[model samples]
Target: MGILDDAFLKSLWVFHLATGSCNNCDIEILDCLTPRHDIERFGMLLTGSIKHADVLLVTGAVNRQCIPRIKRLYEQMPQPRLVVAIGECALSRGVFIHSYNCPLPLDHVIPVDVYIPGCPPRPEAIIAGLVKLIDQRKAQTGQAKV
Candidate 1:
């Protein structure tokens, strides 16, 4: 396999987006990168720009004002991108589901491939979700699962 294909198989550059939340989920996501989790063992990276991202790791419920921004960010990512909605807020809006500011489910905005369900999921759960995504992508592309 070429370098591009190898990169695709082993690495998944992530772009994180927050609509509106209490920041618990965000901190949990950050924790996933710490020594206990060490997501880099599976070649995951947090990217600053959506353009360089291979997966979208979104937290928080979809808010009315942030809909456009989120949609735009998803659009900016290249093809064959996957989306992982972490935490209950991103999954079902959590406690914010009935908030007047809440817009719609994440699926309403962008197609979500996998969902990590929890008020704030553990680091292991987050890494597991990412590994699942990598395996799924490898299967889809007929590449050797890393």
Candidate 2:
């Protein structure tokens, strides 16, 4: 594997973007970072900038006002990017599906690699989704084990 590929598999930097959530999903994201869950041990670090992120962990529904910003963020990420949609809000707008403010689901705004469905999915579920993404990445890069 090349240096970039090795680096990517070693440390997956993530950027969390909240379109318009109720904070439940956001809280679960934090829980993943806490010592109890400690996703960092797997080399998943939450980053503040999209430029440094390997994956985008997006929470909440795509509101009319947030659509452009969400698109901009997705555009800013580097190549080989993966977007993981968290919760029912991002998947199908949850209870806010009827809200006029939320015009579309996340996939409508940007491509999504994985989806974790729940009003607010558990931290374990979030980690599982990330692992799935990692496995997909490995396979795509021809690094998958036989």
Candidate 3:
């Protein structure tokens, strides 16, 4: 990594936004922080507010009611914010695809940086996807391999 890149690299503060989910993905997200996963060891943190986050982990299908809120939240995030579509629902609306209320996937609401796919992806899968996101960020900024 270059000097400029090294100066900026640090713990990533993540914010979780739930459109409307069964909470399966939410649970798995939490699992990532537990003893077994130890995601924090990699410098990822879950923050309660979007303003403080470098990354946003979006869960659930995009229901009509939540569309406006989603856009607002996306807009609220700081510049260079990354969005991760967490779970099958956020990726494709999952079981809610057939419902009239869930008209669009998360990407339609905001740009997705990385997608962690699974009905409720295991914590391990989520971690892998996050690593990819981090590497992508490095590449985007012209940094050497981490």
What lDDT would each prediction earn against the true structure? Answer: 0.84, 0.90, 0.88
Model 1 per-residue lDDT tens digits across residues 1-146: 45666667577888888888778888988887788887878778888989999889889988998899988988888976889999898889988878899869888889999999988898888988888877787777677775
Q: What would the TM-scores of all predictions be?
A: 0.92, 0.94, 0.93
Model 3, span 1-146: residue lDDT tens: 55645544467888998899999999999999999998998898899988988888999998899999989988999876788999999999988899999999998878998999998999999999998887887887877655
Instruction: State the displacement of the C-alpha of residue 86, model 1, in Å, after optimal TM-score superposition.
Output: 0.4
Model 2 C-alpha RMSD vs. true structure (Å) is 1.5
Candidate 2: regions farther than 4 A off: none
Please give the lDDT score for candidate 3. 0.88
Model 3, position 57, has a per-residue lDDT of 93
Q: After aligning candidate 2 to the native by TM-score, how far in Å is the CA of 144 from where it should be? A: 3.4
In angstroms, how far off is 70's CA in candidate 3? 0.8
> Could you tell me which residue pairs clash in candidate 3?
none
In candidate 2, what are the lDDT values of residues 49-125, reduced to their tens digit?
Answer: 99999999899988999999998888999987889999999999989989989989999889999999988999999
Model 2, residue 21: displacement in angstroms? 0.3
